[model samples]
Target: MTPRPYLDITPTQLATLAPGTRLIDVREPDEFTGPLGHLPGAELVPLGTLEATLGGWARQAPLLLICRSGGRSEQAARMLARSGFRHLYNLAGGMLAVRATPVAQPQG
Candidate 1:
């Protein structure tokens, strides 16, 4: 099967995620804690559990996959893409990079 294209973005770009963006944290639950807090509104689906957890993903919306680093999330994104998920994005550098950027507080 042909590989699906991934929309790779820097941590700064994560600030752009709005209500419509489907943010997915592909890191393990333990890894999700500590210094780097998760992106607000992100759905947690550990990479190991992705296959069973994917049934609930919104097929229509663009999926932004994230992890401690870019590696695991990219793998997860590719798998989802192969499974017919259309819009897939890999957050380049993942949470580490995201944490480095100055976060814009969500407007109330």
Candidate 2:
């Protein structure tokens, strides 16, 4: 009905992840590999190219968007929501908070 809504959650709260959750880092390549190392299994997909990258993903696919701060990731999550992804997650505070407080690995 309202399309897949964007869900904002802190990195720590996301520890208990479900299987098939896709981690997408929307920061620039340099930033992703520069200082704040990305999430454990995040794929580097710059924000500029996000739309094209989603071409092959299923509408129901789960996506977790990340960036330097919460801004870009939230934008990405909204973008995914527009694209019809049923499950969307935006990393609140992004890598900044992740660096301050380590994010737990996804539970099995």
Candidate 3:
């Protein structure tokens, strides 16, 4: 299978996602909600649950994978790519990096 393109983006790039793009948070629910709220519109699909969730995802649009740092998301991105997700993106430094950027705060 052809490898999908993984776009590495910063928090600023969130605004650039087109309407159909999928934002997936690979962190556990606790981690997502603990101290750092999730990105608005991001679907909470932890890494362990990605495969099951993939059945319902849109293969056409890019899947933006995010985690605490970038590791888990990158793994998730690769897993999805192997499952034939044509477009994938890894948040360069995850949510922490995104939060550090000067962007509009996301409402929980």
- Best model number under lDDT: 2
Off by over 4 Å in 3: 1-4, 104-108
**Which ranges of candidate 1 are over 4 A from the true structure?**
1-4, 103-108
Model 2, TM vs. native: 0.87
How do all models score by TM-score?
0.83, 0.87, 0.85
Query: Cα miss at 17, model 3 (Å)?
Result: 1.6
Ranking by TM-score: 2, 3, 1
- Write the residue-wise lDDT of candidate 1 on 1-108 in tens digits: 965467888987766755587888988877777578798888888999999988867776788999998999999988988788888889999998887777668998
**On residues 1-108, what C-alpha lDDT tens digit does candidate 2 reach at each position?**
674378888867777667889999999999999988898889999999999898998888788899998899988888888788878888889999888885458999
How many residue pairs collide in each prediction?
0, 0, 0
Model 2 segments beyond 4 Å from truth?
A: 1-4, 102-108
The deviation in Å at residue 25 for candidate 1 is 0.3
RMSD for all candidates, in order, please: 3.6, 4.3, 4.2
